[model samples]
Target: MSGHGVALRVVACGKTFADGTRALAPVTLDVGRGETAVLLGPSGCGKTTLLRIIAGLETPDPGGRVLFGDSDVTGVPIERRNVGMVFQSYALFPNMNVADNIGYGLKVRGVGEAERKARVAALVALTGIEGLERRRIDQLSGGQRQRVALARAVAVQPSVLLLDEPLTALDAALRERLRGELNRLLRTLGITTIYVTHDQAEAMALGDRIVVMREGAIAQIGTPRAVYFAPENRFVAEFVGAANLIEAACNGATLALPGGTLPVADGALHGPATAMIRPEAIKIVPAENASLIGLVDSVSFLGDRQRVLISAAATKVITADVPNAIALAAGDRVGLSVEPAAIRLLPGDTT
Candidate 1:
């Protein structure tokens, strides 16, 4: 679904806390109007800091700039920025009822009682919380409380929506369910959204484009399929999914693995390189065919499939995902084969 019609831009944005910790580097990015862009990375990777800067909760460094549409908002205050934010903790007023909490912003802006009630009622209906108007904050379920928070944020019709790990406080099942619902709701509203989350699955499922960060810098940005299946670097490959990087000698059109040689696709890197392969890409067969041969060291059931860990030559541990019905045990000899097209040769020092 498309994002909101307003573009949010961050140019050369950087942040350093008062305690001398540089939380963000000089990073630049753009979130298109009505596109849900997800900032994903490990902890302390500056994703949250960047979001806070855009929200005007924290100031950017000297060379940083924040803008909405064509207006430069680098010096704008939080209240005047017209941005909606959903926090990880549902920051509802414990003393207020659901309706009052949802209509708090309108009241602060001096909206008349009749107009406030109508707006809050419409938002409650839009968020599917029709009958819980009188419920207290403590009386609602976690998911319901989150919906209230979302309704309250969007009640003002802010220009941009910023979400900071909004579903992380819920249980796994609830988180998954809410993610699907939130995706649908956001798409229906067509609001420009910047979602910050460390959960790769959530980022992949909801984002139109996933921005992978590392050490306060953008590592890679692309569609979920592009980031997962065709990573540009070893870090992106390993971070986005489980990858097996095998040291190999590339000679124009062939790569030398530990046990066998495989033909490389056109434009494959030459000389010493790392061959990146996914666990599921390697198939366990009866005989080796331009791939390695190894003995099964461990086998574990992963619900829909059985993951077999094999010990190949050169002390390499390769994992192969087979069907659950495939009967396999430790000490079994198996040959591994990977399609040439699936073999990604990356140039780097893998040591």
Candidate 2:
């Protein structure tokens, strides 16, 4: 952990609108020094609203407190909080060139011209915007403008960096390319950062710990693998990744399915149970040697792997990810094999 990076804590933080609509419920979270925490969810899930509260752009309702390391900053305003922010809109000055935009913060701080120029040059180099320093904001491409925005935010070297969908403005290819670059840059900076985005792929790519939000509340918070493979509930399972769900009455210790019974650990789950399985966990084999039989409804070649949609496997269509080399066509009867450990059982009905 970098000494310059600060840990953040929020205690019982929440918000409500003027019309009395609660945009966020009381929630608490922590981000360690030099850690990157991603707030991920759909629109209106309160991820952005929470980011605003932490950035000091919005105040929480009473009885809430925000802390940066040992300092309580709930009453602090945005500028005094020493937080750097990046947004999706590429909020750069239209008339300013890249160097001016990057050095604007240092210049505002009354730094010497020599130091300001040195800092701006370093940032321009660090962000790979070297030759574009003299280019006006309008002359830069979307990705270049985004890089400039990041450089501007980080030039101040604040304790915390808050990014709100910073890559959302680019097209899919550019977004993905910039996302990779941003991930590398963030790792190099090692600043305690909080990122907001609805894209699960971005969350998985950049987040050290993902805070999955839904309906203004946190659904689950954990490492990417933990949240995706060992979700606490059905919503977390489906939201983090594609999940194949099976509703079955547990006959003793086993779950009865379409073609055969799936053996589970003793005392694993009883009565009516829901089993969540990832598409990649199912292995395609000869129908005679597998647990379930299904007819392939469709097959999509997804470059590295093929996704085959199986009909009449469980309650819904069972999608399987197999290697592209595995020859399978639509309407072919196939057997799906799932490891006992891969099947995550959820007890009871929807709680």
Candidate 3:
């Protein structure tokens, strides 16, 4: 249940296939000891490529280095790197029982039976698969199999843990349930962990810091709140969460749109600028006193809140989340108000 985690660093790592397709651009990242860093992005992004490089499964381009604590592990094979890996497929042994699968890593390393059994027992209890130790792989449920895979990976007491979409196989409800458990388990083990997933919710929940990648390059890297609230670009803003990308003309003090103008936090910003706003930040107000007004294009009731799409507010349609208590429907005119602080000026045009 406990193991020391080594700090990990990757310096200018890039990857190119034999067919001359570049899978990853140069990426340099550092993961603090015992910290969980999530690499998040859409498919075909360089997140997985970068992970493969760090895990020693794929070699980085010339001059790149992968370091484990103070040791240079750039050239070391995965077996010698002492890193634990859990794949999307779970990869448990069908022929082995739960206990046997958990202990397989130790047995391969020539560990004594007494020590292996002790480690396996600890992991079984840690993963909440106590009575299922003797169960075959096919006999276990999806969640149970996930825990077994996790237990087997950590059984070797690896210096670092690498997980590639570990929960993608589970149902939505089960995925969410196990996500909380995994968060707690990772913190308890204190293992320097790198997780790759396209699910922003998963990244936000598990990562101490998130590295958002796109098209073989890193788009942004920061804490979950920072990434969500202050994205560096339109891509990060839209990908991390629900965002309203507004195109307007800035005249040093306010942003001018077709409906009305909004006060800007920075008066020095002039000319065309792309503004990003979260749906929750927009408040519904009386149209007569409001600066911005738009006609409701659609409304979707979500139990606790309503998602309202409005047009004629900015250069593009905007979405706002309002309390379900507010009665709204299509074709209704509403006013929108946002605090200056809630408006983030993103670089480049929204287009």
* Best-fitting candidate, scored by lDDT: 3
Task: Summarize candidate 3's per-residue lDDT along 296-350 as a digit string, tens digits.
Answer: 9999999999999999998899999999999998998889999998999987843
Summed over model 3, clashes come to 0
TM-score per prediction, in order, is 0.93, 0.96, 0.98
Model 1, residue pairs in steric clash: 2-34, 3-34, 3-35, 4-34, 4-191, 4-192
Q: Tell me the deviation in Å of residue 173 in model 1.
A: 0.8
Q: Order the candidates by TM-score, highest first.
A: 3, 2, 1
Off by over 4 Å in 1: 1-5, 288-290, 313-315, 349-351
Q: Deviation in angstroms for 66 in model 3?
A: 0.1
On lDDT, the stronger of 1 and 2 is 2
Query: Candidate 2 lDDT (Cα, whole model)?
Result: 0.89
Stretches > 4 Å off in candidate 2? 1-3, 347-351
Best by TM-score: 3
* Cα RMSD (angstroms) for every candidate in the order listed: 2.1, 1.6, 1.1
Worst 10 residues of 3 by lDDT: 342-351
Better of 2 and 3 by lDDT: 3
